[model samples]
Target: MTTHTPTTPEQLLEKLTALGIEATTINHPAVYTVEESKAHRGDLPGAHTKNLFLRNKKGKMWLLVCLEDRKIDIKLLGKALEAGKLSFGSAARLMEFLGIEPGSVSPFSAINDREGQVKVVLDTQMMTQSPINAHPLTNTMTTAITPTDLVRFLESIDHAPEELDMNNLAELATKAE
Candidate 1:
């Protein structure tokens, strides 16, 4: 079995530049959660995001990107995506697939998924934000990019994502009960 080297933030930025996608990155103390990140993200013009790495019972993997404050009902999300009984992907699985750790999960990590083993699901509501903030392979910094540019970057890496409006995931969860 061949081992893959994880992509670094510099490399990720290089790829973005090579694709003609422009982004701004700000460096700060490491942040491990949305709450922790808020202190450092003051006035960052855009919707801050939270990314979830999940796996279904069948072992299919998904990367869910939504607004930082959006509430997700995992059970309903599973039903909505047809991913059956979803659970958070383990740290080992995260590194194996997205090439990032728990705190660093971001849509940008799609760059490391050369085999495209993880399907990306983007929140339509979050996508409407003019600029999106995500970690560039590490939580020590946040990178901001236009939503369209983000899609372009993902496509450049051959990971065109599925877009869903997650505003009603909570409602769906309730209905599922």
Candidate 2:
């Protein structure tokens, strides 16, 4: 079996520090979904984010970050992004591109995507929050950073994201149908 070196949470934090991004991380039990995460993140200030790794028909990849509570329909989101039908990227692709597994997907993973193979998308609403919470290369920890720093980190790694209004996306989805 071929061995793959996974990026560890400590390495990711070091990368953030090198980029001058200040972040706070909390260790907790592994949580896969937003609901499960909520139970572990008590009183954590900032908007909790949910990330989606998607691939379009044309092989374009997208990493969408939104507020934990935002409702997203993949078909509608695909139309909004002009990506022409989107599907969840496979676990292997997730690791290959972002250097993380399923439950660990986050904008922080952008640090590993030196090739800029994936386009990062941020929910406009989520950006309004001063601090944003995301996984630190593992589901067992949540790292909090300012939205501005998040953008800076992505740009540092050559993956500056496209910001989209979730409300507008919902409208676009409705209009498409």
Candidate 2 lDDT trough over 10 residues, lowest sum: 1-10
Clashes of each: 0, 0
lDDT of 1 by residue, 84-160 (tens): 79999999999988889889999999988888889999999999997999999999999999999999898888999
- Mark the regions of model 1 whose C-alpha exceeds 4 Å error after superposition: 170-177
**Model 2 residue 169 lDDT?**
80
lDDT of each: 0.91, 0.89
> Over the stretch 1-177, how does candidate 2's per-residue lDDT look in tens digits?
233577689988998898888999999999999999999889999999999999988889999999999988888899888888999999998888888989999998877776778999999999999799999999999999999999998888788789988988868766666
Lowest-sum lDDT 10-residue window in model 1: 168-177
Off by over 4 Å in 2: 1-4, 170-177
TM-score for candidate 2, residues paired by index:
0.92
